[model samples]
Target chain A: MERKTLDLWVGLFVVAGLAAVLVLAMKVGNLSTFNMSESYELKADFGNIGGLKARAPVKSAGVVVGRVTNISFDNASYRARVTMVVDKRYQFPKDTFAKILTAGLLGEQYIGLDPGGDEVNLKSGDNIAKTEPAMVLESLISKFMFDKAADGDAKK
Target chain B: MLERAITGIRGTGHRVVNGVWRLGYASRFFLAVLLHSSMSFRRFHLTIKEIYFSGVLSLIIILVSGLFVGMVLGLQGYETLQKYGSESALGTLVALSLVRELGPVLAALLFASRAGSAITAEIGLMKATEQISAMEMMAVDPIARVVAPRFWAGVISMPLLAAMFSATGVFGGYLIGVVLIGVDEGQFWSQMQAAVDFRQDVMNGVIKSCVFGVAITAIALFEGYDAPPTAEGVSHATTRTVVTSALAVLALDFILTAFMFRGL
Candidate 1:
C-alpha cells in the first residue's frame, strides 16, 4: 500500500481502537458519564458498611442517580460516614432514606435511596440522618444460631 | 572425576556470566533504539508499513482467539454462576475477566507468537544476508534506519490490538451470555457497567498492554539484532523470540497485576 494510504489505515485503526475503549469505559464500565454532569454531595452515616466502597452506585427506586464519592469513619459517632455525589438533575426529598444494598444475594454493595413525602428538597452538604447499615450474612447466621441455642436452653 | 566436577562448575559460571553480558548488550541496544525512535516521526512511512505488517496482519488471530475465549468464559461463567442463582452476573464476570486480564495478556501472547516472531525472522534474515552490514558500510545507521521504526510500530500497535481484542471478547461473551444461555441482555450489560471502573479495570489493562508491548517488541528486536549471522542462527532467534516474549509477557503480567490491584 502507498505510504499515505497506509498511514490513513493505521490512524483509522487507532481511532477505532480508542472508540472501542471509550465504549467499554462508558457503556460497560459506567465511568465517563458520571463525571460529565454537575453533582452535589450528601453525607449519610451507617453503623456498618460491609463491603460498601467508594464509587459504588447510589440508586433511587432502582435507578442510579449518584455515586459514593468517599467513605470514612466518624470518630465521634463511631459510624461509617459515606459521602455521595448525586447528580444535580435528580433531586430527593429531605426525608429520603438511604440503605446499603447488595446487587445479588452476595454481590457488590450499593446505596439505595428511598424518597420520602417531604416538601423540602435535599441540598448539597445535607446530612441524611436515617441510614440503614449493610446486612452481614455471617452476623445474621450467628445470631440465628445463638437464638436457637438460647431457645433450646430455655425449654430445658 | 575431580577435573570433570571443576569443569562443570566453571561451565555453569561461564553460562551465567554470558547471560549477564548478553542482558547488558541487549539493554544498550534497546537504549539506542529508544533514542533513535524519537526521530521516528521523520520516517513515519516506514513506521506505518511496519505497523501494517505487525499490527494489522495480527488482527485476525487476535479477534478469533478473543471471541473463542469469551465464548468459553460465558459458557463456564453461566454454568458456575447459575448454581448461585446469579446468572445475571455473566456479563460482569466475562467483561471483567476479559478487560482486566485476558484481553491484554492473550493479545500480547498472540502478538508475540505472530508479529514478534516475524520481526525476529525478518531482521535475523537481513543480518544473515549481510544487508545490515551493507547499510553500515554505506554510512547508514542500521539501528536507526531499520530497527527503530519497527520497534516504535510494535509498541504503538500493541495497546490498540489489545483494546480491539477486549471489545470483540465482550461481544462474544454477549453472544453466549445473552443469546445462547437465555440471560437477561439488559442485566448482562448493566451489571457489567455497575461493576467495572475506568481507572481500576480498564486503564490498568491498557497500562499492562502498553508495558507488554515495549517488553515484547524489545525482546524480538534484540534477539534478531544479536543473533549470529547464519541461517540456523536466524531460526534459533525466531524461536527464542516467541519463547522469551511469552515468558516475559506472563511474568510482567503477574508483577504488574500485583502492583496495580494491590489494595483490591
Candidate 2:
C-alpha cells in the first residue's frame, strides 16, 4: 500500500510538471491569452522590420504602452506591415508618429509612438502612418571593425 | 604471441574503420528494428505502457534531485551575476540553463545512476538465472522483447523527465532567489517569463533530452545484455552502465553544444 501510494504520487508529480510546462508553452505560443481584455491594435508600414520581432514592446515616449503583435509583408506595396497592441489606459492622439527604436546599445528594438496633441483620440486597429524603420548598430560596428581590419593599417 | 599481437592491432584498426562505415547502417538498422517491433498496433500501445512504467516511475527521484539542484544553481548564479551587477539576469540565466542543457543532462545523469545500474543488475541476473535462455528456447528475440521495450521506454520517459527537472529546478531557483538571494519574487518570475521563449531555448532542451535519453538507453541496454552470468558480473555491469552512461551523456552534451551554438 505504501509503495502503491508512492507510485501514485510519482505519477502526480510527472503529470503536474508536464501540465505546468504545457501551460507555459501555450501562454508563450499565444494559444491562450490570459485575463487581458485591454488590447488595441495599430499598424505601420516600414521598408524593413530591422531588429524587430514579435512580442517586442510598443512604447510611447519611454514607457511601454503596448507590444508588437505580428509582422507581415504588404505584397503589393513591398512594405512591411507591423501590427501592435496598445493598453487601454494610455490614450493616443490622432497625429502620433510611430518609429521603431533601439532600446539600448545592444538591446532589441521596439516601436515607439510620439503622440501629437491634435485633440483626437485614436481607436483600436488605427494606423500610425508616419513611421521610421530601425537602424541596426551592429551593422555600423561591423562596417567600422571590418573596414579597419581589412585595411592592414590600424590607423583611424 | 608476437604474430597474435600484430593481428590484434590490425584487427583493432580494422574494427575502427568498420565501425565508421557501419555507423549509418547501425542507425538505419535500429530504426528498422524499432519500426518492425511496433508494426502491430498492440505493440505500440504496449510500448507506451512500458515506457510509462520505465520512465515515469523515476519522477520522484528526478524531482527531488532537480529541486536541490535548482537551489544550488540559484545560489551559484546569484553569487556570480551579483559580481557583474546584473543580478536581474539571474532568472534568465537559470531559465535558459535549465531549459537548454542543465535540465535534460542532469536528469539523464540521475536516471543513469539510479535506473541504469538496476537495469544492468536485473538483466544480468536474468541471464544468470537462465531465464533469458528459457525465453530464447521459446523463440523470443530477447533484444526485441526486453531490450527494445526498455530502450523505447527510456526514449519516451526522457522528455517528460526533463520537463519535471526544468519545472522543479525553476521552482527551486525561485525559492533560493526570493528567500536567500534577496530578489523579489515578482521580478524573478517576470524576468524568467520575458527571457524564456518556446523556440529559443526551451525546445532545444527537449531535443537535447530526447537525444540523451536515446543514447543512455542504448548504452544501458547494450551493457545489460552483455553482462557476464555471475554475481560479480552483475556488479561489474551495473558499475559500467553508470559510468558509461554518465560519460556518454556529458560527451553528447558537448556534441550538441558544438552543433547548436556554432553559428549562434
Candidate 3:
C-alpha cells in the first residue's frame, strides 16, 4: 500500500511537470499557433524588407493578429513580396496600410497594419496595394552625413 | 639547478598523464553503467524511486528560484526597456532569458548541489558500509542493480525539471510585468508568444538540461564509486560532485549555446 501511494505521488508529479512543459510550449513558445488556428493569407509588396523574417509578427494597434508566412523577391518589380497569415477573426478593410516597423531602436522588425476606412473587407487572396517599406537606419544616417557635408561645401 | 628544473618538468608531465588515466577509467565506468542499465527492465522501479528523490524532491528549490529569478528579470528588464519606451518587451526579455539561458543552467546547478550531491553521498555511504561488496559476493552486479538506475533517473528527470522551472519563471514574470507593474496582460502574454520559438528557444533549453543531467549524474556516480571507503572520503566526494557538476554544466552550456545560436 505504501509503495503504491508513493508511485501514485510520483505519477502525479510527472504529470504536472509534463503539463507545465506543454503550457510553456504552447502558450509562451507559440508552438501550436501555426496549424492549430484558422487563418487567411494576404500578400503585400515592399521595396525593402530590411531585417523582417518569415515568422515576424503582424500587429494592429500593438496586438499581434498574424504572422509573416513567406517572403520572396519579385525580380520584374524589383520588390520584396511578403505573405502574411492573418487570423480569420480579424477582418481588415481593402485600403488598410501595411507598414514594416521596428519595435525599438535595435529591436526586431515586424509588420504594423493600420486599418483604413473602406467599405470593402479584404479577402484572403487579395493583395494590400499600399505598403510602407522598412526604414533603413544606415541609409538615413548616411543621408544625414552627406547633407551636413553638402551644407559645409555650400558655406565654403 | 638544471637537474631540478628537469625533474620539475617530468613531475608535471607525470601528473598530466595520471589525470588522463583517471579520466579514462571514469569514462569506462560510465560506459559499464550505461551498458548494464540497458540489459534489464527489472530495476525500473528502483529508477522511479531515485527519480522521486532526485527530481520530485528538487522541485521546490527549482520552482522558487525560478520565480525569484524571473521576478528580478522583470524588474530589471522593465527598468532598462522602459528607458526606450519598450517596457512592453519585459515579457519577451524575461521569457527569453529564462528559456534560453537561466532555465537550463541554473536548474542544473541547483540539481547538482541538491540531488547530485545527495546521490554521491548515498552511494558513497553504501560503499563505506561494504554493501556493494556484499552484493557482489552474492552474485548480483552492483553496477546494474545500483548505479545504473540512479543514473537513468537523473537523466530522465532533468528535462522535466528544467521545463517546470521555465514555466514557473514565465508565471513569475507575468506576475511582475502584468499584475504589479500594470503592463497590459494581453500584451505580456502575446509578446512572449510572438517572440519565443518552440524549436529555437524551448527545445534547445531542454537539450541543454538533458546534457547537463547526464554529465552531472555521471560525475556524481563516478565520485561515489571511486571514493575511498571512509566517511571523510564520502564527504569529500560529495563536495567534488557539486563543484565538478557546476563547472561542467556552465562549460557545456557555453559550447551548446554557441552551436545552437551560431547563425543568429
Candidate 4:
C-alpha cells in the first residue's frame, strides 16, 4: 500500500476510535451531566440513611442539583452525617428540609431538598438542621401492625 | 508398571521446568521490547503502517460482533427486567454490561484471534526464512525494527477498539429497545446515562483493554521469536498465540474487575 494511503487510513482509525470514546463518555455515560460545574458543600444529619451511598444524586423538586460527597457516622450525635456538594447555580434557604427519599418501591435513595421560607440562603459548609431519615420497611410494617392491634382492642 | 509411573512423574517435572523457563525468557523479551520502543516512535510511519494493518483491518469484525452482542443483551435484559415491570432499565443493563465487562473482554478475544495470530505467524515466518538472521548479520536490530512497532500499534489500537465496540453496542441496544420495541426513547437513554458513570465504568474498561493489548502482543511476539525456524513450528506458534491470548485475557479480566468494581 502507498504510504499516503496507509497514513490516511491510520489517521481515520485513530479519529474514529477517539470519537467512539467521546460518544461513550458524553451520550452513553453521565460525563456530560454529572458534577461538571463548580459546587458548594452542605451537611445534613439523618437518624438512619438506609443504604444511601456517596455519589447519590441530591435533587430538588425532582431535578438533580448536586451529589452526596461523603457519608459517615457521627459517634457524638448518634446520627449519619451526610455531606453533599450542590451546584453553585442552585441555592436553598437556611431552613431547607432534607429528606432521604426513594425513587420507586425498590430503588436507590437520594437526598431531596425542599426549600423553606427563610430569608437567608445557604452557603458553603452550612449545615441544614431540618432533615428526615429514610423510612425503614420493617419499622413501617411494625407500626401499622401495632396501630391495627390498638384499634382491635378499642373495638373490643 | 513402577518404571512407567516414574517416567510419567519425570515427564511432568520436565514439562513444568520448561514452562517456567519459557516464562522467564518471555519476561526478558518483554523488557527488551520496552527498552527498545524508542525506534517505533522515532520512525512513526512504521507504527502507523501497523496500526492500519491491525486496527483498520479489524474494524469489520469488531463492529459486527459489538452490534450483535449489544442487541442480544438488550433482548435478554428486557426479557428479565420486564418480569419485574422495570423494562425501562433495558438501556442501563445493556450499557453497563457493555462498558464494564463485555466490551473490553470480547474485543480482546476477537483481536487475539484476528491480529494476534497474524502477528505471530508473520514474525515466525520471517525467522523461518532467515530474514531475522540476515538483519542481525547486517547490524540491524530486528527487535527495534520489527517487534516494537507492532507492539505499540497493538497497545494503541486496543483501547480504541474497545471503546468503539462499546459505543457500537450501545447503539445496537438503542435500535432494539427503542426503535424495534415500544420502549420510551427518553427513558432508555436517560436510564443509561444515569447508571453508567464515565470514570468508574468507561475508564476502567479502557484500562482493561490496554492491559490486554500489552499481554496479547507480548505473548504473540515471544511465541513467534521462540519458535523453531520451521514451517510446523511457525504454525504451532500461531495456534499458541490464539489459545494463550484468550486465556490471558479472561484471567486478567477477572483480576481487573475485582480491583475496579469491588466497591461498587
Q: Which portions of model 4 miss their true places by more than 4 Å?
A: A119-126
User: In candidate 3, what are the lDDT values of residues B1-264, reduced to their tens digit?
Assistant: 999999999999999999999899999999999889863357567887888899989989999998998888888899898898887788889999999999999999999999999999999999999999999999999999889989998998898899888888988888888899988888788778888988778889999999999999999999999999998999999999999999999999999999998745
Candidate order, DockQ descending = 4, 1, 3, 2
What's the true lDDT of residue B184 in model 2? 74
Q: Is candidate 1 or candidate 3 better by TM-score?
A: 1
- Candidate 3: clashing pairs of residues: none
Ten residues in sequence with the least summed lDDT for candidate 2 chain B: B38-47
Could you tell me which 10 consecutive residues in candidate 2 chain A have the lowest summed lDDT?
Answer: A27-36
Please, what are the lDDT tens digits per residue for candidate 2 over residues A9-111?
5466457757756744553222232213676778889987787888776777676677676888899999999988777878888889888887555555888
Best by TM-score: 4
User: What's the distance in Å from true for residue B67, model 2?
Assistant: 1.6
Where does candidate 3 chain B have its weakest 10-residue lDDT segment? Answer: B38-47
Candidate 1 chain B has its poorest 10 consecutive residues by lDDT at B37-46
Error of 3 at A105 (Å): 6.6
True contacts kept of 3: 0.69
Which residue runs of candidate 1 sit more than 4 Å off their true CA positions? A36-44, A69-78, A81-85, A88-96, A115-129, A141-156
DockQ of 1: 0.63
State the lDDT of candidate 2 residue by residue for B207-233, as single tens digits: 888898888777676666678898888
